[model samples]
Target: MKQDGDAAVNVPPCFISNHEGFRGSIKNLIRDFVVTEIDVGGRRVTAASANHTSPCASSDANSQSSAQFKQESDASTDCDVDATPPSFDLSVILGQSVSEELEQFVLTLKDETTAKQELSLGCFPDKHHRANVHRVVRHRFPFLMTITIQPEIRVREDPDYRELSQLVTEDEAEDFFRFIDAKVRGSSYTFGPDDSKEHRTAVHHFMSRRFGKLVETKSFSDQGTTAITVRLREQGRPKKRSGEERKEEEVYTGFTLRKENLETLEAISYMAAALGVLPSDFTYAGIKDKRAVTYQSMVVKKVSAQRLEEKAAEFQKRGMHLSQIRSVGEPLRLGRLQGNHFDIVVRDLRRHGTSDTHFSAANAHTCLEELVKEAVENVEARGFVNYYGPQRFGSSQSVQSDHVGLALLKEDMVGAVRLFFTPEEGDDPHSHAKRHFLQTDNAKESLAMMPLSKAKERLMLRALNRYGTGPDGCAQAWLSLPHSMRVFYPHAYCSRVWNEAAAHRLTTLGHRARRGDLVWRQEGQNKLEDAGETSLPQIHVVTEEEEQQGAYKLGQVLLPMPGNTVKYPENSMGTWFQERLARDGLDKCRFRVSSLKLNLPGCYRPLLACPCNFRYRLQAAEDGRGEVMGGSSRSDRQLNGQTGEGKQGSLVLVLNFDLDSSCYATICLREIMKCDL
Candidate 1:
């Protein structure tokens, strides 16, 4: 019914169906082919069918394509699944070295000269590029290359003084004190149970074990407490006591201060107070030199004498003891004694080939002199004030985990209430474990929801690269450097990531560590409601020159108050910390980087594993001219029969600063001094 010229037979413009039958029309729609009739030279008519691929197809064919698409998608998903594992465990503690890396990273920003800098792949300042280069070195040659950094140090005080003091232990308590009777002049003394055989044996044991060669008694008595009489001699002869003015107080009764000097005695008294013991119980007769070993007597109160003796027994284990006790009714007084004795031991020393071991001792003596002078100056400058140091509550015993715990207490809940009643090792290791577990689970979920957080940060950096102008991408630029400077800024990014992750884990998993109780609004009144109790307020710490000076002035004005109450809250520490940061001009200041100095003393020859280069020597010349190794061994000697340069031992010198309480001085010193290699 339709002719080839008919416009009603609408088809694709690329093809014209010349099907003369109904079957041909159906076939043209089913198959992707075109039917056309062409005339050559306007003489003959020809029929042709052209086959091609069709974009449009049946539902079954589309379903097959979708299935193939899903297979490829699954393969890609599996590959990505292996990239981010569930967990990681690194044994190393990323500390000071990491901080230096971060410092270098910041310094390398190219647009740092400008107000703002853009972060990108390649464009970075020298310092930043060096940082990245160091990171690469660390990744590639962890063993061959080492990185060292300075640490951010902060000091803190303990808040459990009252609770720790009041919680007494039986082992540290006293027993009954026995009074020795001397008024009745007895011919012989016997000690033990009232039985004759037991009394003789007890008397012999007491004379042998208790008195030793220090004291000799003629006789002893045993009732509830034993009594011993001293056989006194006068002018190389035994003397008889006159029966006049027989004082009962002359018999042994209680303990008293053995110190002779007033100032040291007062210092010890104050120290005892900090230790939660009475001045009477902290008796030492003569003031021992601070630089030497000294022995003195400490008295105990009659009521608490037994417990004080027990505690003294504990001190005895640590080279301190109650050598003797005397009855001083009005409590122990200072300034009535002789000098102290000292025995010193020094070991494991390093000696120079030129200097004897005695020289090292002399150096130590000089060091000690300087140390004592500094201590005296510091005390004098501070006006000899008395304040509790870190050791008052054994804070020095805590390690890095304590710091982590402190941060958690400020930001996590579980850590806030995790009670460690005693200062023992690994106390409550799992206290924060469960909390961290929960937080990690939550973080996993929440961070996923915020995946765009990282993506956006990266995108922002990239956009800055294109539109903004500033510093080079110090983050990545270091990768383009040669081998030497590659380890300059090692672990910069990784440390930051690790710290952030750790903080996040602690805050999320640990207890909610709020600074203080929540603020409450008054109900039906203008007055505020009660808030919950919290730990002691934290002190504001400032290290900048101006701010620190200001703080020092403030400290001078603020006198010590009783108990732990203070003018500021713990939350103020961070705010003041920010002020110090601004004062230091750290946000804008530039740093001059240096390389690490390594010493290799006691060396036979330089090894390949060593990072240091050795001095080389030249052999004799073949020509008439003579060649000297190290400028001729003969010329090596200079005036006074000494070489121009003396042989020096290899030693690694690392300069750093540590902000810690006086009590934790040993902790810092040990960490620095304990490095053998």
Candidate 2:
């Protein structure tokens, strides 16, 4: 027999045929009871239906809800359990129930008195403890229907690491994947995914966007390379060295350059050689392209500023020029580039021949339009997914995002259950029950906090710390779960091997980019600390020089009264600025200014108008994944009247770029512009 509300119990080999006589003594075990007699070899076996009862109390609201749902839905939730009843007849073996004659003989050999005593001992164990034996059997057999469920982990698409250099040809791209697959040995690499769904979503986001700017980019026939110079972010002041430390080491001035997707490195190397120093003596942050313009910082110790200047002159003789040289403060590392800025000049005048002047300006106009549109769209769409980028994991490894996701879901499910448990009574009953039975808060506190917002943040931090590797691996877990959970309590089980696995894979193989690729942003003026201690660099907008030149003319139109007659509208920063300019008589003025600045996050900087024009600064900020924060500001809002907006009336070119401490923004920008550099 089975316990109440549980499944049927299995029959032990020692059951007696006459045990049914005592069935009346068992409470709740008599409902629709059925028994079957079977003959095994020469012995008799009985199969009896285990007793079951409806749940006595629905303390768990979720469980109650499930029950109610089934009651109303007319579904077959119980079909699997009730399909087979325990009442079939199986006493006969091939139509032969232990021969009557044999049965009689066996009965005679074993006296009824002795047989009854043995049967009683086998069924009841100790005569005085029949209830205990029954309870033991019920607990051990657990007459419930057995269920087998195999969980499946989700699969995520690998992150795309394709760069200008990586896209040599279709075949080369295939080969690169193959190389990566081989390196991973089919170990299943994930792109720092917290869950499969999130990973897939991120992949789709990347698929929808373009990599770099459009106007200045060019195509390559073969697997081409570009040189990019990654200047180490300058340290405002040098670290003080102790006398003992200073004397312990030789002050080596320069380092060597290695090959990669850069042209600038080659030029720099050539220049170094001409200056009577071996290429090995010139240490660079990273190698740049030979065909494209790449800029970086180089260090030379023991050389005076005059000698450095002389070397610069010698480099110019060999088609290379060193613009400026500061103290070689630190050793340059690889894969560092501030964001890249491009000024491409495309010729061949597809529309008009070299001699014809009036053939057409159509092609130039079309090209310009296409270039601007592509740049805006690509940047807006594929800006950032915020997960650990490919660089965090090596080019060869992929992460299993599903594991991270499941851990997150498990957390969520527990939280949901807890929410349902919250009753107006302050849950004193549930608390007592929980303490007495479960003695864990996993299904309560830990899981209760798994909403998308909270969970996503935790997942992101987990990914960042794991793959980004600013701090130690174990320490990253604290960023996710509550600190109290770390004590000898419920949180102990939260940090399972699986959870740690997701984090483990994150830190070691974080670098996802192959080679010569980057994420670009503008360099802003102020230090990041000024932007409310923001995590990302600050990117403030600056007026292009071209615009600044026309400021005096523009000011003349807007400031007719000059004496602050009308203050700019409090809510109409953009409109007031525009109306002020319109009042000036320079309506037909045509000038374009191209401005460049570091696109950091959380910082706002104003753009200066020409000598007299009003200044408007850009406010661009990005999150952990190089994603721009804040929406389109007034400056970014293109003017769209009957004619159009952002139609440049002035033109000026500025050359500059900014990179993070560990990234090469120039390479990233080059890939976007499709330029040689």
Candidate 3:
């Protein structure tokens, strides 16, 4: 499971050829990672792979790529010697004081008096088939005449060596770094992610968002408000057909809803329940935050304006109501709308300085505002890493859903079911109870004990009880859950793979294209086309200078989202992508289970995203109580306007911006806050 919420770990260091390299730290501050997916024509088209090519493979010759990769790795296994032998040494000493003359004569002994000894030493062999090359040393014997010599008793003070390079000459340090960098673009040690980067940022202690702060506005395709009345032009046909009055064949009731402290899925569930349809019946462009006020459009199908008007009170009772409801020809589907407009208020300003500096609480606020301005300018100029937000994974602070995805990839049905059903870090009472009892033989009794609100669990448990909760039963039970839920198992895995790959690409390659690195196509449909018939996606090969230019213009690169038909790049980043899957105990083959094919097809995400139309305003925070006063809620109708007419205090920063669909707002916030969200 992705425990990215707490981000309880640091960015693990990267290695090249088993040697340490320049390391970047991790960040975990932002909470409520929301995505405002910008609508593109369609993300359905994926990069095709060469015939029978495995994601675990690194080259184009099928296993030849993997084998070629093996050769490269095999070549890198050569170890350099830390200790080199110097020339020979000879010594003589006399024990008796009367023998001072003899000692002096012995001390003057010539090199001809010493005998030479030659020895050979060998290091551990690598690749098993290749023997270790031996080093030969020649040492001259010490010449002594009628003398007793006391060896010098010396103690060497040694400090612990933190890295391998510590044994090398200081002059070799740069060579090591350069060697790793040169081979890093393709070596697993350089780009392989041992641990994932935590993108979450911590919320400032003084800052907090007052929930139910959602404000909303709306627009419709027809530019009309409300669905109570409808008009039909009949599209060049007579108003009346076949002697009967022409009637509307379809209806799209579009309205804007801004619900405070409510999950978008739950709100849609409420609307779905009220309309006597499944939650899937209604579609939305993207999911919004559950903790704060988020405004988004909704288009319910086949519902009349009168019906919507009649249910207004019910919607309000459910902590949400529609406004600017209008009828159109089409129903809403995911990614139908443009993007979300976020009017977020981050409260309780506190100033923090870099490691070299500190800020007093009095000036902290002032310094914080200035920092945000500076960070905002930096963000506006460049772009933020388009990392997947926490929302992509479920919001349980403890155990995560990604583990289940990985389990599914490994085909561990028992493990997958256990992860899905068990009470996890963020599971509720019902979830806990269901998981606990369902594991027992009395699964039926446990089913009766579960609440109706635990519908998904209940359905799965019912299937398990009937089939007898063993492997077959669990498989049957898993099959009984919603297709979307089933698909999530793999999708979550895909998200992690993407997260790790992107992080590795950025850290190792940065923004510039390196030699052998694949760049996205600049023209045509702007989509990466298949490289050749039965080969991977078409990519551009750029010069080193172009790579540098690309880094300057972020987003010049593409980050492949992991999937069945998805082709990873052919550069060092591509090797890392394939290696990461292997490290995770997954491969492209695992993605194509006939039983779970709904989630098989994959897509591509940009390596970076700059928030467009970004802007922020700083203000003082209001007293906690005054934040949500006159807003209508499930309990009571408090205000007529969407947002209560009130001013935020002088202690908060109110930020407003329109983000591209699937772009993380938290990333932008992290760049500015320079701390946790």
Candidate 4:
């Protein structure tokens, strides 16, 4: 008997519990699913838990000692007091008399009214002359900044270089140069992709010499030609500070982030934008579900508590709240948390294969409570199959993330790109752009049509336009995505295989410590804390004696996701892994993609997940009166409005449980409900 939803990802159909399941819908409203993070120190972070103290709070003597050490370190690097500043003449090197312009620009810097000023030294077409000008500005005038301006090239039509070579004439050549001059006022030159590396290097050198060493040159391919843009680097000089002040400055601000109906990245992006910092500057233990009210710990580098507090109102308007703003010695890293505590309300409950008529108004509450109690008790005793939840596959019904991963593993770059850009059904915001690209094969035009919120799509489109859709181009396109997003595709594929393998193991051999099964040694479990989320855990195969003695429980048994480094079970399950990979057009060796640096040395996951501190209650959900524990009345109003209509007197199973990091609460609910989620 296969599970109702097993066909989508080939999950195991068996259930650990033998009790009758209750019928209900989860996530009927956002507040119905509440998640709170548990920190490594076993502290559950809630919206109201505010810690004003800093993580680095220490004795005054220690602080003074650190400050003194910093002062000495700075003193050691100080230049000699008698050293003389270098001087040079810019007029001779620039081949012009620009002393007046330089003097005027310097004068503006002293005025409080003038915010910024730039002095453009005339362009030098000669490489040697440009080099001398750059050298003079750096050593002689250390305070002044310089930049090289490159001409922007817009290709009117795709040019055939072979045909152009045959039709070129002296007048046409002069006309082309004249057009360039008209476009950019004779500031720079353009080169084709076919240009030799040495030629491109010479061009770069000429630009650097003509401008200054501070100027940066970047190359991009457009329509079979490489366009190099030279511009001033935007980095500013660091503010001078005393060594003691530097040591006293807090490096990070730790806070508890409470958000509703928002993804973790989305919330972080909003905060980063408001704080005038990149999203990469913020770090967190794990990603939370988007359709739930979640509370998690987050830390941002160099951001102050006051700054974060000022944005509290704005965040609240967007369904997010920040609290516990305090100074910390270090940023929060992924997997630093112990786990998450969930408060889930499964509503409109009924017995499986029974209708609402089965529960008359007289005994509705009593019947539902008995059913829920039995199911919860079974889960508490036996636990549930630790299958990767449906969300892991993806929200899309048309295309799954694992599909893209398989394409990448098979070295089908073009296929992978297409799969990533494939739009979902019914009014997808990115559908217009994706369809445009699929139909016209014009990445540039499609990019213009794409929304800024579709960052991954836009990133791929930009790379496709600049790099083309060949193997190397596609690989580069994937590489251009953020590391977190890039790893998701391959990781999704690993999850799919792991789910199937785990299901097979339970179905074939039962959830028990088999002789060939692998389990984490005691020390290996200890290393899990220090290894972080990305690192693999150590494991060893169980011996016959250990299996007979029942040294390892089902929860200790491990299953490997397909990877080059992972060890499969030493039984028929191991052969099943090889067969599954063969069907997917892959072998163990293919898991390592050196070009992309995507070496999926997959890790082990337990076969069973038992929820801690588990408890449940069957509540009478009346019309316009449904309430969620730990949720605001306003949120309860929203939930009641959405799910309470015509659901009066219906029973709701409110379950409270704590799960270890990476375990899915949905799987636990699935075993109790025993129906498609």
Q: After superposition, how far is residue 36 of candidate 4 from its true place, in Å?
A: 0.7
TM-score winner, 2 or 3: 3
| Minimal lDDT window, size 10, model 1 | 605-614
State every prediction's TM-score relative to the real structure: 0.19, 0.23, 0.56, 0.64
Model 2 lDDT tens row, 71-152? 1111111211111212212112101242232233335432645332111112111111222222222222222111101000
Candidate 4, pairs of clashing residues: 130-209, 130-210, 131-209
What tens-digit string does per-residue lDDT give for candidate 3 at 100-184? 4333443443233552221111111111111101110111111210110100011111111112223333333233333322222
Cα displacement (angstroms), candidate 2, residue 238, comes to: 10
lDDT of each: 0.24, 0.25, 0.46, 0.64
Residue by residue across 1-677, what tens digits does model 1's lDDT show?
A: 11112221111111011111110011111111111111111110111121221111122433323321111111110101111211211111123454444334434532345412211122111111222333332332221122211101111111121121222221111100000111122222322232354654554455445333332355445555544343211111122257454243232224322221123333344435444643334433333322222234444433344444555555444333343343333333332221111111111223322223321222433432233233323322322111211222222243323332232212222232122111234424332332332345232332233323222222222333343322223222222222122221121211222223223322332222223211111112133111111111122222344343342332111111111122321243334423432443322211211221211111010000000000111112112221111233321111111212222211111111111111112112222222111
For model 4, the stretches where C-alpha displacement exceeds 4 angstroms are 1-10, 49-251, 273-276, 302-306, 355-361, 522-538, 588-590, 624-648
List runs of model 1 lying over 4 Å from the truth. Answer: 1-297, 303-320, 330-346, 351-418, 421-677
Highest lDDT scorer: 4
The TM-score measured for candidate 3 stands at 0.56
